[model samples]
Target: MDILDQLGAVREGKLSRRKFTKGLLAAGVAMTTVPLPARRAMASEGEQATYFTWGGYDIPELFGPYQEQNGTLPNFAIFGGSEEALTKMRGGFVVDVSHPCNQSMPRWVQTGLFQPIDTARVANWGDVIPELVDLPGNGAEAGKVWMAPFDWGQTSITYRTDLVELEGEESWDILWDPRYAGRLGSLASGGDAWWCGAIKAGIDFANIDTPEAFDKIAAVMREQRPLMRLYTDDTTTLEQALSAGEMVASMTWNSSAVLLQAEGIPVKFARPKEGALTWVCGVMIHKDAPNLDRAYDVIDSLLSVETGHFMINDWGYGHSNSKAFDQFEEETLAGLGLSKNPVEILNAGHFQQPQTQEWETQMNELFEQIKAGF
Candidate 1:
């Protein structure tokens, strides 16, 4: 069968994931042998904007309105991490829009690669959470917004309710509990894992760069190492492990719990007594974006209540648009462990703050060493 047929079979469960991947590899090799113009022509099919973002976000569900209006999904370029995306952009890779979180907004603004977004162009501007839009460095001047906040959520322990028992109110300390040692997982990115460690260590994130805080956080992470089964940023991998009962618990995003619950996996996303690590992520227009108008359309679509409903109801994240919360009932919000007002949920957690480049580098390096059991 052809690549499309093979892909269909994979989706329909007629083909194993291994075989489908092999088919894709073979198809990619065959495509490389095609003429350059043919390859370029193939890539140009209904392409409106080029979206640079994390892997899972390239899906059509987040931009349904854009697809319906434009008759195509934006071309996507996936990045494993924000730093990788920035490095590529600096290396001259041009994309109409890029996604980054509040913590990285300051650094991204300093790069001067993004321009201020005209909120007047975004139809859903007034409906968006003001706190998210007013994130540090998200605006160049009074009233000129930069990024259009799209998604907000927490990173916390997701445990198998059937396999694990709580000794007290849910907390980050569970990852260090010896009872589940060797059955736990964590995100590989220090950007996330390090902050979670700080929460567990009782370190103030605003003062996280201090020697005392660094040392204390490092100790907490080192203690967690031996207890972990793996360290990875791939949410699918962690969710699969949880589904197969291979892992009792792991550090994961809100989406993991949503996905697992849909599949009838007995998972619970912890609301740690110390507080969860929360973040607001959004899209920014590249300074030299070729499809500027299309970029605005994409942002507006993302901010729509339709997209917001998908983000909250399907992905277990808080949509930036306040009107999105109106679609759900109080009981449903409570079941998902979310608040009707995004600000209340954001305030309840240890919201991530911008960190200095030096501090980020140091924390990443230290976390890497600890993960290596050093």
Candidate 2:
């Protein structure tokens, strides 16, 4: 069915909302179009906690445990990117929980809008991956932390294997190749693109805070800007563009490539020679959580093995629960670009380092200017 038809089905209650949203995403709808007010699960809306997150994450499969216990999934508010989500929460749009990745963790904490997660409250706390949970600046006290690690993965190029005529081995330079101008796409958010720029500029991530690194990355980004046909935070737009041969390549998370591949599209999530930008992202509770207990339940549910399995097999992300890997063999994991040893994959890439809020602002502003053709 067409997107309009699927949307109509959702409105008529003839289709599940999750299916409608999933169809929209696969059909290339921009994520920014998701309404700002939270979309509550049809049943038990009043008692549900609100989960603010990225577009693909609000589906019901991830909330299995919470639904079994509470009889409904938490209300969901979608954002195109983490920085946008943080901006909304900063404007006093309180949610029970909001998702952010490692690169922005410290800055989120600095905002003083969130409370640390009490490990004791989470049922899956023990099985959660240590390396994922031990992100820098996320520590709260003896046994708590700011974020409960959930999905972890890379931000890298996903290109059409059949269409992108490679001049050499996969690398970050492919995005800047003049031959592909007006046929390439990229994520607009600095959270992904600017870091990839840091790689393309050959700046060491440890010293990424330096003024020199900033200038170099900015220069590299500006040079690549004109080559991009589209700059979007929505995977749908990128996926549709690639699937239809409208775009030959794009910067994307693992899911886009995986989803396209499932449809028998020949694509590769590039293992850029420099390194893919990698990080761990999870859930953070609000300081004034209206449904405090349910918020913890939401975090625990995401950390569960059930959710972990879905995240890995379906989303092409690494889940925090260790046992989630047991169901799949080394070969299956390898096929998906994942491993039981997440730290191995994480360390193999350019793992994101926490930066001060000021640095994030400056970097994003610089990126916006470049995207604006400045």
Candidate 3:
């Protein structure tokens, strides 16, 4: 069966969990695999900006204004994780605009691969939520914005509510609970899992660079290693596993829960007592963009309320534009666990911060060793 049919069968309970997972593997869905939506070719006839971004963002719904103006979508390339995207750019894969979260902006800036954005050129700059725009390292001292903050979301525990039981308040400790060992999963990206691990270990995110804090977080992750049935950056695979009953719980973004619920899966995105891991991600212009004007157009279109509507309504993420929240009712926003007040949501969780390159290198290497059972 094709992917959509397989998804339908899993959602309708027509396919067993094990069979569903096997089907996905047979269909070539695995770790670090970008979704099929991102594999399409760039428009050959137009002078378009090359956009490097995550899978779902490549869809035309997010760039309607640009398409309406140019009559074609931007040239799209995708990465499963931020570190991989950065590595490619560092190795000279030039793209007009690339997406990276707040945590990685410092390193991206350090690489000298991106130039500051001229906010005047972006039509929606004035409408963007300030908290997202003013993130550390996002703007230079002279007030040149480095990234155009467009999307915000959370990384939290997404569990099969029908299968997982809670003792008290929900917490990250559930991932380490012996009862669920061998049925748990996590994202393979250290950018996410490591920060989540720090929260679970009771280490302050700001102090994660300290040796004492590092040791504590390392211990928690090492304990979690054997318990995980799989570690992948593929959100589709993670959602499929949860839907199939192959995984009772996994560390995932808000989009996973949204997607599963739409498919009739009994999943819940936990607002852990320790707080969820929240983030803001946006687009930055390449230092040597071939299509600079089109690149600005792409950023402006993405930050528009039309794209914001698609982001919140379709993908369950918060848009950086204040006008976007105006489109939703209070009850609807609350149900989706979002608010027009970005500060409330941002303060409700452990917001990721930019880490030093040395610390990031050490953390990723250690996490990989642990995952490999070394």
Best model per lDDT: 2
Write candidate 3's Cα lDDT for 104-189 as tens digits. 99899999998989888888888999998889877675678888999998999999999999999999988988899899999999
Residue-level lDDT tens digits of model 1 in 281-313: 999999999888889889998999998998888
Q: Mind giving the per-residue lDDT tens digits that candidate 2 earns over 1-374?
A: 87666656555445555455456556556435754234434655447899999886776779889988887778888898888898998898989999999888898998899998889888899898898887788889787899999999899999999988887779998899999999999998899999999999999999999999999999999999889999988777788788878899999999888878876778999998899999899999999998999998899889999999988887788999999999999999988889999988998899999888789889999999999999
After superposition, candidate 3 runs with Cα above 4 Å error: 1-39
Looking at model 1, the pairs that clash are none
- How do all models score by TM-score? 0.88, 0.92, 0.89
What range of 10 consecutive residues in model 3 has the weakest lDDT sum? 31-40
lDDT, residue 198, candidate 1: 92
Query: For model 1, what is the alpha-carbon lDDT of residue 317?
Result: 90
Candidate 3 residue pairs in clash (backbone atoms < 3 Å): none
Candidate 3 scores a C-alpha RMSD against the true structure in Å of: 5.4
> Per-prediction RMSD in angstroms?
5.9, 3.0, 5.4
TM-score computed on alpha carbons, candidate 3 = 0.89
Which model, 1 or 3, shows the larger lDDT?
3
- Ranking of all candidate structures by their lDDT, best first: 2, 3, 1
Model 2 residue runs over 4 Å out of place are 1-46
